[model samples]
Target: MSGPVTLPAILARRAAATPHAEALVIDGVRVDYRTLHERVQSAAARMVAAGVQHGEHVGVLMGNSVDWVVLFYAAASIGAVTVPVNTRFKLDELNYCLKQGDVRVLFYVDTFLNIDYTQLLRDVEPAFDAALPGEVLPLLRRAVIVGDVAGHDARAIPAGVERFDALPDTPEWRAEAAARAQRVSPEDILLIQYTSGTTSFPKGVLLRHRNMLMNAAASALRIGVQPDDRYFSVRPFFHVAGTTMSLLVALVTGACLLSVPSFDVANVLTMLDEERCTLTSGNDTIFLMMMGHPEFRRERIHLRGGWAAAGPEIMQKIHDVMGVKYMVGAYGQSEASPNVVLNDWRDPLELRVAGWAAPHPGLEIRTVSQETGEVQPANAPGEIQVRGWSVMKGYYNKPQETAKAFSDDGWLRTGDLGVIDADGRMRMLGRLKDVFRVGGENVAPAEVEETLFSHPAVQLAQVVGVPDARLGEVAAAFVVLRPGTQASSEELIAWCKSRCANFKVPRYLQLVLSFDEIGMTGSSKVQKNKLRDYAIREFGLA
Candidate 1:
């Protein structure tokens, strides 16, 4: 139970156990374990050939494809760490991650629409710009292009950029690479996942091979993944849920992974029916989209496994429609390997609750009142605290922020408001920081947002507390309607009044055509701070 469990070891074990099993299916291209192993080795060999050494950070900025997986394992095989950059990030944000990680090599797709790499690096730096055809990525000593860049000039290639497709396609190369990969150890740092800076600047979350292996084992236990299970992962692989649960869990269990590079409702529905995926999970918004899809039939979308952090109503809808055997509702942030709590899908009641903490084996959970600093009794709401092996090493390069997150005794302050029932089930009330005072009463925005989302015409809703003279603060709602849908502000206000307390109902309503300005983390959680700033600017609220 305590032996070294590194990424290379996991791949080697799977390859040895089920070499012929279909490991991945991307755009209908099936890659069996045997072939995957060979490719991983080849990729790793090529990295070594290009001078990638032990412990160097390699940045992977590619879409969800087979090559992405190959490059990831290749880096791991050579004792190099990988950083999966968010594809959705703007150029500046992407630049920050590359620099912070001190990436020595970068593997990226040729181009994504609206994201031109050639233009982005035009003014990057002299050393970075002057590097040979395979070396244009400044902080990045070497670069590999995954797809075709046929017409692009070699001199324009910056310094050290090379086409991955141009690598020598020889069996010897593959053999040598595979041999090198087998040497990686479990203690090596395999990944550096950057935090989704919702409240502050992003930080790299360093996860060692053992950290990933243990988390994957825990998740596999929690979700009960089978070898034959087909997982449809629409979430981007850079996020913890996608990397640990969607990708690693599927790989560890020898299940087939069907990745969707980006979430498109139509594409998801088609994939669900066509692939007959047995397990899938994402934010509540994803479940809502699937439920509201026109062709949504319980027999098709919900087959075996579904998990998310959602409200009670949505959980009921999933149960009623999908007939999912395990509709797990859980909560956790980026720091705790992102899978601290999960509800067993077998129990109907547990499915309705927030989630039960994962069997941490060595983790402790406690609830304490923020005001009195006293441990709360069972069923009493308070701030949740945890201490465990699963907690992050620390927020990269931010000791002050890391110190603030943990108590003197080492309990990680989760910043989540919850209650532990008599049976030890955790019910998430809301985020403590997100809670706002309205008329001197604390109001969790999630409560009002869920209520607003329950309305027939409401597609998405976000509630923010604004300054008010009489009540000290009042709720202001921003709503997005379904296509061709319309509802007056008065109607929405009245609906809120009928569903929740008078003070909880939003006094101001803003019907938006789209939520383009509202930035979302890689996992799809709304950036409420952005919305709050927009409200203050537009409405002139002090």
Candidate 2:
């Protein structure tokens, strides 16, 4: 039987198709499809009582949990667009997304992984303590806490904020929610994914029900997902890898999703063995950490297959050490609902390890020269471009960036160097854009440079990606201090750690005399390639 395309319809159909089947497993809680659907319905009704309207942005700032899942589905059921916040975001980053996303309602946890969100929200807007939405976040009217704040009584909760459990649930509101779900169309905007581009600020990529649902189905097809399968995914729920690739894949296929609140190598290994997980997925960093751990035993692992975004060496290691014999390669960005191309598990090991994959049905992939906009022949490297049903509508509220994202003919410019073989299998060469990935997280050099520039003693800063054994790449910095000012490399690195996410922090820092000493063009633009080469040799990273 064909499944539904929209999120709300998918949950309902899954509940009817497999009411008693285990749909989710998180934090030691096992929820079946029927129970999951019922929880979503209650949450949707509460949203209606809170005065949330259709198409309004609902921000969810929490780690992976049953509450997060329910809130996402609930928002979709009532036609509200979910704006998932990155748990790694600090105060400033969090505030930026809240304002840029135009969030009217926010559902968050008091704390997760020792990060005090209650304090973070208070820092975002001081009026949060008084329960009154402030001018800082004018669009935000309602705040809902999903769980209790540690060491705090119920009365201590903020005045304007409401507890998720306390949200009103009535028959009338539930009926209205269901009616709203029926009106949801596949073309309706489902979520606005904020991802780091080749700029200092992150841009929101608008995705529709058809874009994400179809991508999830395609990933499920490639992995040969089955109802009896247990899918373990450590990918954070805030990322498209979690939503479209893991969560929706499970929902569409009736697979039980073994969710992780936070990634712990020891805990993950224990869960894989105890849960008898049949499938799991992650980048090289995750797989390498698990295998490198002393607790990892190949005999105890039951994972048969899953997709990975890694090079050939790591793919081989995952197969040899981790025993994921059918592991396949993947390629995508947030703008394409995150899964433009993925290899089939049934393919040969050599093909699967090649880092090339077949594009999803109805998607087109080609390469064009960087210097000229002319298309390249098969097997020749060029800038990878795509166009199809999966491409995002556009970046929210950024018309110029959105226009630059596409070509004159409408192909979405991927900004990655790649090649398409005669067989139509696409393989990535390297990034044409400066944006680099650190353990599956995209890090824009401009974002890090901006953070470094905030330091008082720093006059100039340039960031680059350097090779690492554990993480695929880590940030390295070259700094030119202010006149007569002195700052140690450790001090500058520590300054960044306090200001930005861990992945964005520079692991290595070098004090340089000037940009001219490194390399500069006629326009005085710092040549990043030359700096990266210098860092590689100086740090012995090559």
Candidate 3:
């Protein structure tokens, strides 16, 4: 029970400890630990009956739901790698992901938000024969659909697709799945999570069961996760942040997840209060919406601790506006099981907010000069490199990219720039590739964006570098105002000029209506490359 923490082992331990505990509660559906365990077992058996072999890749393209959780754990238990695809992906994006991952079977909801997936699949590949591997997705042999597909409004499932509701969960299949689960190893590759690529194409990060489980256990303990804690699950399952930190952490700690499919401030606040959630995690945009909600003060929210990774300005505002005082700030990316620096739950609010994060146990962190490969002094920003038990195996099948990812001594160069403070806490500065030089001075967009957030008129601020004839590059600001609030480009420009250095001030400003206009990934990271293109076109800066 103590060594080699595997997914099946975690599931078994939790179910035995608290079989009747609430494991998942979402949209009028509640499932206890025992029920969840049984569902996962049945799903694993059904997958085997459908010809899913051990170590095969299974893709899940669905919104947040009980079934999505079941598929994830079931695949892990049976030694199959689960690829979490963004449900928001269009046909082309979906095809690219499925093909690149070499997914053998895909499970997707038939319809979500007015889009008919079955039709989309047929449209993408006109000759998609379900009985054989898909023409577009050459490895896909099975398409499992989960939705209301049997009633009057239901459409006929394409050939080779099976409705999950109609699949049999026989005792024989369950026994077979159990036998398969017994053979699953802790070191087996179980996840192929794609990084939300902002500047370049997404790469599949290969992760094993130990990478995920150990990170989950260590991170959960760092945040003081309790068995009865109600974690407000807002992050999507496709991202490591959602799975490693929220869902898997729940299984490790016996916590219950109050799932949120999308970010709706009113609904989130209502659910948080109704479910009596003790913890919630999100970035600044999410917490800002929560604080700006009309019912925030009235709800008298009951909470203890959660993860919030906005910079200093937004973190302070969250504490002031939302009374979210017991939150932790951390840093990481998908390749490191999504956790490198985690805040100790016992730290004071000031220490937690000011210091980005202290290193989690079993991980080594250092900021090394990019040019010399020498370690930087304290408070000097450099590329943050990590070596730890939780680091991923490698990028799936891309040997050259994988070779470039790690050093000869085995440390994974994170590509993120950071500074270790005098107190040994790490503060993320920005990405090394994201820095823009303004008149020979290095300008980190995050610094400018953080400054913009301090302005009362700005709700969300994203700064991107734009081409300038003389300066080589100048900063451009995209501002999203708070609800019912308005601001002018000239006004924000003047505000920046007053607060920031002349070179650091953004040269151009544009007001954006929504994040879609900014081209955000499903994980909520801003697509800066898209913003740069928009800035260039809008300003005629060619």
For TM-score, the strongest prediction is 3
Q: After superposition, how far is residue 170 of candidate 3 from its true place, in Å?
A: 2.4
After superposing all C-alphas onto the true structure, candidate 1 shows an RMSD in angstroms of 2.8
Model 3 misplaced stretches (Cα beyond 4 Å) = 1-3, 127-130, 150-155
Q: State in Å the error of residue 197, model 3.
A: 1.6
Clashes of 2: 1
Over 4 Å off in model 1, which ranges?
1-3, 126-128, 132-139, 150-156, 166-183, 353-359, 484-486
lDDT of each: 0.76, 0.86, 0.84
Per-residue alpha-carbon lDDT of candidate 2 for residues 167-262, written as tens digits (9 for 90 to 100) = 899999999999999988898899998884333567899999989999998899999899999999988888888899999999989999998887
On the 0 to 100 scale, the lDDT of residue 278 in model 2 is 91
TM-score winner, 1 or 2 = 1
How many clashes show up per model? 10, 1, 0
TM-score for all models, in order of appearance: 0.92, 0.82, 0.96
lDDT per residue (tens digit) for residues 311-401 in model 3: 8887787677767667888788999998899888788878777746888877989899977989889888889999989899999888999
Clashing pairs in 2: 131-160
